[model samples]
Target: MSDLVDQLVAGALDRVTAWPDGALARSSPPPRSVLPGSFNPLHDGHLNLARVAEEMTGATVAFEISVTNVDKPPLAVGDVRTRLAQFAGRARVELTRAPTFVEKSRLLPGVTFVVGADTAERLVAARYYGDEARMIAALRDMADRGCRFLVAVRADGAGRVRSLADVAIPQGFARLFTPIPESRFRTDASSSAIRAGRRAAP
Candidate 1:
């Protein structure tokens, strides 16, 4: 099983792989919508967000886990299996090498990416891409691929709840983002906090 898992992760590094609920793995077509996350433990917050996203978009939401990372090392086989286990019997998932939305857009064009407010904030922040011009170019590339974002509410570092409205989207890219009203869904559960709690446990 571990050897198979290793192969799956290796293949995903080259192209997207789809794991359907209670089914086998295969190549992925462009999903209508995707909720990409690290899913360290696949908590309720993620499930609720996907539920709301599906209801709003009228499309089945597939979960995505990128084995590659921009700031950290790629996930090891054991780590990938642990995260993939949480989705078993619950949701379909896609494994890919895309570490950024721009890369993901190119792989799965015309898909709506379900994201939290914090992610949407970073998407438009010039610092993330080195400069405003680079940021704009990346966004233009995503838009050109017909990618859009569905932003959900999330609490910022200051404990203030933020939605898409709080994000400073660049002028021309406004249409690429849509907000999931706080009335529809909200969750305080965070994977970082969960991991911290586990580490603190005696």
Candidate 2:
């Protein structure tokens, strides 16, 4: 790894710094809304989602990528560079070690998280947090931090379109989410499909 990448990785591990090309100066204001993703290979779907989110919230959307993940291995130095490159001249990005939204909320308080229906579903799943009670607690913490989610509609594996309404959000925490109507945006483009060579890059 180059000296800059090494420094960035260390910063993410130590202080949860936001790296937009270079370190985000301490004077920079925290982002208002962020679309956290693996990006794998950013496509038009991701771009359109950010654009619609910006219009809906009237906030400039920033992209976030966690160097470490719960389900996947930590990104190598080269992998991190490749993902960050996709955003060059396109959008602002923050590199982090926060693998979950709850952690991300702590790092970026009072931010709206832009996510798809599939991610919203996983966010509420009890399996991820060990039990329903713990899951509720996590949501409560995120809410307390003034974190909210702007969810977009996405197609399921069975080809059915799912919206925020389709997610089984905990009763009291339902207010944390707002749906982006299908009328406003929809896309079949997915990074996984593209990576698998099943679809062309958008």
Candidate 3:
């Protein structure tokens, strides 16, 4: 592992359990914008979005895979390897234990998280934070930590789509999120569809 991954992993181990192995770890500094996802079946859409995000943020774009998911089982070594292999020489990847954006912000400060429309909706949703007050508090903490979000629009399969502008973000925290115009990037490529056997194997 390179120093960058080594440093990230060492810091994360202090609070979370993780398993990572591959060439995705690099000696260079981690990216300010991280695109976190399951990457169940890596595809061109993922690469396209990362490329666009890097161009906009001028930060090294990293593909982050959280070993610990909120509703899914922890990823095993095999699962991590299979996914990392998909990256090849395309991008830098990281392993983390953070399952939610709030935790991810606390774990890595001064980061601009690039997420899809769905993830952004969930972030501001009260159910995820237990209540509106808790959600507001989390957003406040995230902003203080220099964490922000770049939300990409996502298609809802019913021929409808939602972008960052569509979601009602927390008051006073609106400055923390940036929206990617649909004209620049839009895709219906979702991991859920791939898992449902709708997408072909790469």
Candidate 4:
């Protein structure tokens, strides 16, 4: 367990501060639907997926923020609160110290994570963990914890798009993921892309 996770999970009261429909929520058991991201600025692309994910799985939907970003500085509590406010009656949100999917599975056991094909692809890749054995071990751990994944299509460069089927998941872990067809949930809108466009605009 990491320092932040220890502080947040110590009291048996919370997995971290949570907000459901703009109101503070009690620390919960395994989450139903979890869309994990930085969510620097929540956008419609996220909302579209969340709505669809909830409908498809018939599970509660919530956005999850990892204060311990992979590269950036940890986010302030106020910043996290401000972002959660944006959901405002639209959805629930969670704040956590877990950065990678492996960590998230431990924190949000039995969760059905919503991810794009790009992210799902990375899950089986070795570079992310620097070795294939470690990656497989981590994924197996998630499965053992009863966590699963929902993957959607995403636009690649040159306007090309890839679907869940496009990702070559490992054989043993294939059952742990569900694919949403492109027709069902495809989106080119991304926060990073949006920021880049704004930066380039005159």
Question: After aligning candidate 4 to the native by TM-score, how far in Å is the CA of 5 from where it should be?
Answer: 12
Candidate with more favorable, higher TM-score: 2 or 3? 2
lDDT of all the models against the reference?
0.87, 0.84, 0.77, 0.80
Best by TM-score: 1
Model 1, 30-95: lDDT tens digits are 789999999998899999999999999999999988888999988987898788888887778877
Model 4 residue 201 distance off true place after TM-score fit, in angstroms: 5.3
Clashes of 2: 0
| Clash numbers, per candidate | 0, 0, 0, 0
- For model 4, how does the per-residue alpha-carbon lDDT over 1-202 read when each residue is reduced to its tens digit? 4343345434333356455544454456656889988776788888889889988999878889876768787766567667767877676677777889998898888999999988998988988998988988998999999999999999976787877788888879999999987777888988888878888999
lDDT of 3 by residue, 116-187 (tens): 888888889999889999999999988998999998989877868999988988788889889988988999
How high is the lDDT of residue 103 in model 1? 88
| All models, RMSD in angstroms | 2.0, 2.9, 4.4, 3.9
Those runs of model 4 whose alpha carbons end farther than 4 Å from true positions after fitting are: 1-14, 199-202
Please report, as a residue range, the 10-residue window in candidate 2 with the lowest summed lDDT.
12-21
lDDT for each residue of candidate 2 in 1-202, tens digit (9 for 90 to 100): 4454555566534223345455544324558999999998899999999999999999999998888889888778789879877876667786777889999898788999999999999999999999999999999999999999999999977889999989998889889999999999988788888788855545
Q: What TM-score would you give candidate 1 relative to the actual structure?
A: 0.92
Task: Output the lDDT of residue 13, model 2.
Answer: 47
A best-first ranking of the candidates according to their lDDT comes to 1, 2, 4, 3
For the record, the alpha-carbon RMSD of candidate 3 to the native fold, in angstroms, is 4.4
